[model samples]
Target: MRRTTTGPRDLPPLGVQQAFRLPETADVVLPEGLRVVCLRSPSAPMIELVLRIPFLCATENDGATAEVLATTLLRGALGRGEEDVDTELARAGCSLGAVRRSDRIEISGSGPSAALETLVGVLADVLTGASHAGTEVDRARRRLAERLPLLRARPSTLAAEALRVHCRGDSPALRLIPAEAAVASVTADGVRALHRAAVVPAGAQLVLVGDLDPERTVALLAARLREWRSRRPVGTVVPRAPEHWQRPVRLVDRPGSVQSLIRLVSPAPARTDPRFAALSLANVVFGGSFSSRLLSNVRERGGYAYWAGSRFDDILEAMVIAVNADTATDTTVSAVAEIRAELRSMATKPVTDDELRVAGNYLLGASALAMSSQVGLATAVSTTIGFGLPPQWLESFSDEVRSVTGRQVRELAEEMFASATFTGVVLGDARLLAGPLGEHLDMVLA
Candidate 1:
């Protein structure tokens, strides 16, 4: 049998035909001050719920306490056993979990649209009536303790933590990983106290997305969550991470390691800043995507690392631009040099029209894809809400990305990627990296 090869197939035109639009959104503020941002997606059969509680810990110990509380929030609630809670959620075609961040405690859940009420009721029960059983707390503490060593062993993790500590200084956000001693010391009573103090209606934002009427859904949630109230006024704001101008390069020694993890941290504009769109486009061209300069230079062209990328994190008033790469220990210096060169180029040179167009389309495409599902819609809505953006902000994103000119990108790049902007860390075998890295950086051994 002979197979005949045809001529190359024509590819379809890239980019959306029209501007993407967000689902209809409704905002409601309950009497208890729990704000609800609802997105009605009739096409989806599932409901997605994202509840964000402003959860800044007062002390480093409180960080571990809050994490344990979040992990065990749904272990048992309203006199029900852990198994019973799981059974109820399974019956409703729902699953729920909570994560504790430096700035917020996010409780995320999803289920069939018809069982939205059941999910909300379960969440409310967990919020208001969590048992915080001694055994459960001990188990969670042990689990967290057991995970610490594994996390510490990863070079990438070490580099990221160091970068956070360097950029955030003494801010509570610097406590990304709880201390094992602190986790061990967290008692059930402590967890309960932290939960009661931090998880309050006034400090919470509930974002729901699904096939339901926004007003009716908000009313239902209001009634369901009414039982979970707080007496104390809620204003637990995380302090802004202090700015660091010193460009110190710290080396976290991992004995006999074959690869090095490089992480760079710099200040960035917040999401609400008018230059955010331009900066975002600049990042995309720099390293935000697979077709970015960092990947091309460090991985594809230079073969200095297996992967490379950069990300911008917008945490309320705080913002950070982080670049990450992993490379062979022998090529660590080369990879770092390439990364530094790329950062300098971003500041000194204007991006081409093609770069701007590709970045704009990529951003718009990503935004459209993010809003295509119930969960994604909920996440997007919650993120924008966290950024203090209005519901209509989503509708304007495509236009904003499209309107970003190359000049704007260049200006933002110059502002964001100046020589003094970056402070970084490299984690690897110091014996292999220290001499070479010290030649190019002000090295500090950790």
Candidate 2:
């Protein structure tokens, strides 16, 4: 039978809830100070591994060097050429790659269960004997130097960078993008030095989930990482969020542009907070999802924008809620007003029971889907531990979401969004925006 529904609230109930549980896991610390978390999920004969190396540095200027280092880390290591490394991984039925994040360098890999030992050996080799050869470093530098300028010119990138600079001073730990000049100046030797200093296992974590024995996996890691030693832990520094911006909203001029980018951000509670789930639900009701009030108001109904939504982002020691929209240049002012109005509505008006139920179910379903695969399970475990949460935190998080009441969502929303907490940048034509946006928001020309 074809079912008709007016809204998420009208959808059928999710039937009896099954208790969420995680597989048995073994957590161990190697003598070399490396933390390994292993889980035995025999659903498939494959294993996924994630290694997080804290890559904090003293100054934002080091970001360029860090990028180059990550690019060349696995290019050629331990006297093995790039092709040789590829052939070995292929023979082991393994695939490996890396990405440089603001605070860490994450190396992820997966392979058949039988190849766990071989995969670990390749990871160890990359960690200790990465060549950072001049050719590779130079090639990476040129690529970054060419790409960064284009990235900087992007409207979305401009808004994000502006938000970071406004909320948190430009520090190495919070800076998201490196300057083009910095990328151009990175050298082979510099990349190598940064690698030696920041890629140690002392303060790193490794997560493995698949068809593997926890004890044996731990033993393998201990044996393989025996030589991966360091005297000092990876340096970490948490940047503080400023209480206020010089202006509540900063406007950047993109002359003759046909569209405008609006980004709003505010501090959010840590994941460990008891009320975090309520706030998370409130975010969904307001703007985090397609059916969210912010999107329904601006894009679906008002036709002020084509893209509009909100999300939560995690930083080193904190979290933030951000709302973003890309709208026609002429609708920029109306879009901002609608966004602020939705925020006000979310705070002042108590969310309906239907709205609360819909958001809660979405959160629960997303959590379930996230843990349904080896890669997903591994990522979930990695993220949980990375946030300083217990390995079983996922088991209880669903309950937290289910228990949140509409009243609590309203109160939390009022506390979080019913103020001038948001500070952001709007990229549009100043000639068309200055007069109207100035009256609607406390905006300054940038």
TM for candidate 1 is 0.93
Per-residue alpha-carbon lDDT of model 2 for 37-143, expressed as tens digits? 99999999999999998777576558888888888888989899899889999999998898898778999999999999889999999998899899999899898
Candidate 1 segments whose C-alpha is farther than 4 A from its true place: 1-7, 15-17, 233-240, 314-317
Clashing pairs in 2: none
Question: How well is each residue in 1-446 modelled by candidate 1, as lDDT tens digits?
Answer: 99777899778789563676777777988887789988889876988899998776566687888889998999998899899999999999999999887678999989999898889889989989998899999999999999889978866667766776665555655667878778889999988877777788885899988898888888888888888887673344355666555657788888999999988778887777788888899999999999999899999999999999999864335678988899899899999988989988987667899999888888888888888888888898898888788767887766788788889898888878765677777889998888889887877887
* Candidate 2, residue 323: lDDT: 88
Our model 2 lands, by Cα RMSD against the true structure, at 3.1
